[model samples]
Target: MRTTHPHPTNAVEPPIAGTAEARRVSPNAGWWRVIGTVLGIMLLLVAYYWVHKPLDLSLVLRLGGLLLDLAVNIALFVAGGALGRALLASLNWAVVSRGERIAFEALAGLGVISTGALLAGMAGLFRGVFLWLIVAVAFLIAMRRGGGSWLVDARAFTRALRPIDRWARLWGIVACALLAMALARALAPPFAWDALNYHLVGPARYLSEGRIVPAPDNFYLGFPQLLELLFGVAMSAFGRDTVAAPLHFGFGVLGLILVAGLVRRHTDVRAGWLAVALPLSATSFWLLFGWPYVDLAVFAYGAAVLVAAVNWREHRETGWLVVAGVALGFGAGTKYTAGLLAIGLAAMIVVEARSRALRPLLLAGGVA
Candidate 1:
């Protein structure tokens, strides 16, 4: 049976209610009612912010700019994901044979977040929507010319998970929903202390000052900034709090996927699904909900290094070695704990293939 959606923008209905995207509500016909509703919401918001401090134009502008920052960041991320999909097509198909779509989402996310950090160094002047939009449009054009579908990969991914244990499936859904709500709360102004202090402020200052320079008074200014750099870029570019936790959260999800992927690669199907589903129960994972901490980013970089290390070992591909090194370096840049990845990699080599471990270690050493 074929089902057709008359409106392309409307989401396809899911088999499970509330688990899928809901129908869109258009305000085109009830324009006056929509205006009244928006005004009412604005009044409620004003009351809330007034309770915290007071309502003012400066605060309003800052809040409004956050929206702009999120928009620019999302645009750049979509472009990066498309580029990743294009690159994945060129890589050894085995790397993404089973989880092609989710892998693309992870890789694409890494692309955008990494690009923001890498470019922030050079883009002191070009941190506006104009620059990001141009960068993003160019990618969209390039990707349109190159054919592939994220949706197709997503559908396939769902199909593969259909065979997973039903209990695991239900638990995973519950975990995902709870986590999503946690991240969603971050959409409001930052309530955490670190974010108000340096996690977000450092980047704002850096962008305003036109370079990353010393902050004599601020203690965290000297700390490693792999993840904070992205936060700062979004803030500086948009002149507001961009709520970086969700982007950071994506890294954690990518970690889950990569970890599950390795399990699937080495173990059975059921075990692989368990690997994918079981991590949501961890209390540690819940702590990261919209927090400005860098643990997830560190985990992601380390996971990338590990996954690449395994790939290089099996395929003897120098590119994977280089990737592992870059990711390790990025991890270290995010947090000092990432240095542990190098030691872990060394131990992995000693256990798996002692003679050749030094080759990758040296390569990763130079990059890190």
Candidate 2:
């Protein structure tokens, strides 16, 4: 005779006490509390501002314009990311991790956009219409080339993510706050010395003259101007220098993402958060956090080079080497000091690929 079962075949087991699942609060109450606290603080800040100085129509109108400009700068970045995704897809690369894919696409896309702008500026196509046309064309091409599929993949990845532990959430909040402060500074008018001297000056002059003209007085203009070219794109498209700081801030954000990504790939999630926190907390990093300077761009592309190089080492994929080379090229373009990165990367390749290393080094070098 068959015996009756104590529980159904699909019966759920209660979480064991002291285990992670058991420790999790029901309905994510912790998140609600965090959200409430943030909202309360925001409301208080607004009330204080209102009490100190009444909001005027002119102030509201000015804020609206700033918002509009910010939106335009972000839209340009999104277009570049889409275009970069298309370019990567064309390469037939098959990155499995969503984080990796996002990082690579953003870096590659921005590099492509910046490089195109540089070429266009050199060819005297730095006018508003041409800059806007480049952005439009990139957007159209990205849409044509599997943009929908990429979006679906991204959505699925986010939906499938596991709930973060409390420590992770705390660190995440810190990171966000830091980046938010940097962004607030970026949205303000740029006053950084280097920015006024050559960074913005070069872009302003280029926009006025409608090309990349020689600047004999400003020797800094002679440096590889990959970052300045991006500034020109923003200034030309939006008619404001404020957008340029945010654009540079974007590279700083990318640097954070890359630091986290590289660490997470090699180690674990906890380590990744630590990596992000460590650099972001540095006084040196904060010094240029939202400045319209090329330092962040150099940091970003240099990080990309390492990410691609490490990925190539692990997976032995030829495409990753090309990616590394491209990143190095962009990094070098952003600042000549990236030649130092190239040296470090070359040594790394040789040390890691001890046997038959010539081909790999040659490939990355040729691409760079």
Best TM-score goes to which candidate? 2
Question: What tens-digit string does per-residue lDDT give for candidate 2 at 1-368?
Answer: 99999999899888776567865835476677899999999999998988877778888977886797688777766776777788888553454357557667777888888878877888998888887788788778898996545555545754743426776666766776787887887888889999999999999999999988999998989998988888888888757888788888888777777778777766777677767667778877876877889999888888888888887887888888898899999999988989798888889899989987899999999999
Identify the runs in model 2 with alpha carbons over 4 angstroms from their true place. Answer: 1-53, 90-96, 148-163
lDDT values, one for every candidate: 0.65, 0.80
Best by lDDT: 2
TM-score (all chains, Cα) for each model: 0.69, 0.81
Model 1: CA > 4 A from native: 1-73, 85-90, 97-123, 129-163, 268-270
lDDT of 1 by residue, 1-368 (tens): 98986878667654443332322243244666689999999999988877877757798886676576457556545555555566545556566445633553445445445555556555554354534554555466547845236545645765765546776566567656766766665555676777778887777776666656678999887788867766664565546665576566666766766777787778765666566556656766666756766778787677778887888778877767766777787788888878888887767666666776676678767866
TM-score of 2: 0.81
Poorest stretch of ten by lDDT in candidate 2: 154-163
Candidate 2, lDDT over the whole model: 0.80
